[model samples]
Target: MLTDRTDTRAKLWRTASVQRGYFTAAQAKDAGYSYQAQRYHTQHGNWLQVDRAIYRFREFVDLPAEGDEQLVRWSLWSKGRAAVSHATALTMHDLGTASPSRIHMTVPRNFRQQTDALILHRAELTEGDVEERVGYRVTTPLRALVECAAVGEDQNALDIAIAKALSQGLVTQPKLLYAAQQVGPRAELGVERALAAAS
Candidate 1:
């Protein structure tokens, strides 16, 4: 490595350190690494590729690849274009016993990228519907249940999630009802049933 590049690499390392050791290709470029240099570094094991266009410092590459760390890495890979949502948000908020087999995220309608690890739902979210938590953004609890109610597969699980959220004071019946109605009539059934059971 060139001596001059050391400072640039240090800056990139500082950024990646805050993001749980993940940095994107664009971030690397911004930190003065050309595509060729990035490839060389990764090829030489100075950085470890996490996903396409995403890399983690080789020093931190040995960290376990599950739970919140990986979730933060995945979110960084999205380039702030997605917010965790639905069942994943419920799990993050500790509102359910059921764990989703895949992470759930919402991207703007025009955003495109498909991957096996995440189920991406496309919609524009209102500012109030999203909240930042643990260095990443997620849907508000009521919006999470509302989105889950709209497309979630299991009524029993959804009800349990709602009950838990209610008990935890994460959301209220009126707010859930309002969120459901905002998504239209089809979504109302699940929230209504969950509310009934909780009552």
Candidate 2:
């Protein structure tokens, strides 16, 4: 039989793998790590305390995080239910000039993580609307544009993004139209207007 320590290590390892080597105190507790033990591990160099109640396996601590490290930590912060969206996603997909002051993410309507660093929107995204990245998720170009337009992202910027996406095949015209129609009148109007200007 595995010792208690071995069993706990295995459980935490499994949890961290899906989270890009990061795990929360709650998760550690659920995996049989008591609060005191968590402190001990951190003190002993077994786990890196990354943020408030957040820990990372030293193995996956360093990464290509220069621009994206925080994205992973925040993804873990959301417990893995958020996808980079809105202006942040548009920037990631290289579709728009939406350099918002804050990062953006889409979570379930009930997900209420409040922080000044992020702008959280609520929506149920279809699988096709999200693209999985190294340690986080982001909205597809088509979805990002529709979302930005629905929220009244600047018209000229949306137009530029739409034109760029279409030219580079990041989003097809028909697909953009269908997605816009699904969003509502504003999105549909924005997409149609952009398409007309482009064509």
Candidate 3:
């Protein structure tokens, strides 16, 4: 029979598994770890303190795939309001070879987190504009390509994303057309140009 402590550890482990080993103080509290207990765990090497109120379980760090940890961490840092986006979203969807120098994210207008590694955009995302990753969300392929084009990220990156998405059956041209229509003229033109480039 599982003791109360074992039950709590199981619950926190479930959350940490999805998040690639990271969790917030609030989450630890939810899993029944008091602040003092958290401090003890960190001191004993069971948890590694990451940022203020953020932590990583030592065993779980070796568990994530490449390129996803930063996204997961920043999304947690935003308390889950931020979506990995723009060129970063394109890469998340495996549509490009881009290794962006900065992590681009879109957050709700009221959200704020300043960091040298992050390029944050303020916007409230519609459900269709975002997709779920294991522990975080990312902008949809259509939104990502359009956003990159709108901000003049890189023409070739847009072209490659659209082309690869279409080729992999990840998106259809009609779906792309609908997404372009939703974003309005400048973005529509941008999507069209990339679609043309892809074809």
TM-score top scorer? 1
Off by over 4 Å in 3: 1-3
Report the lDDT tens digits of candidate 3 across residue range 1-199: 5349988889899998889889998999999899999999999999988888889889977675666887888878889999999888888888867678888999999875687778998888999899898889999887887787677767777777888888888888888777777766766777788889887
Write the residue-wise lDDT of candidate 2 on 1-199 in tens digits: 5448888889989988777788899999988999999999999998999888989998876665546666788998888899999889988887757467888899998887787788889999889989998779999988999998899888899889999998898888999999999999998998898899899
Candidate 2 regions exceeding 4 Å error are 1-20, 26-32, 44-46, 58-66
Lowest lDDT block of 10, candidate 2: 61-70
Q: Largest lDDT belongs to which candidate?
A: 2
User: What are the lDDT figures for the candidates, one per model?
Assistant: 0.85, 0.87, 0.84
Number of backbone-clashing residue pairs for each candidate, in the order shown: 0, 0, 0
TM-score of 2: 0.82
- Give the 10-residue window scoring lowest on summed lDDT in candidate 1: 61-70
Preferred candidate (lDDT higher): 1 or 3: 1
Clashing pairs in 1: none
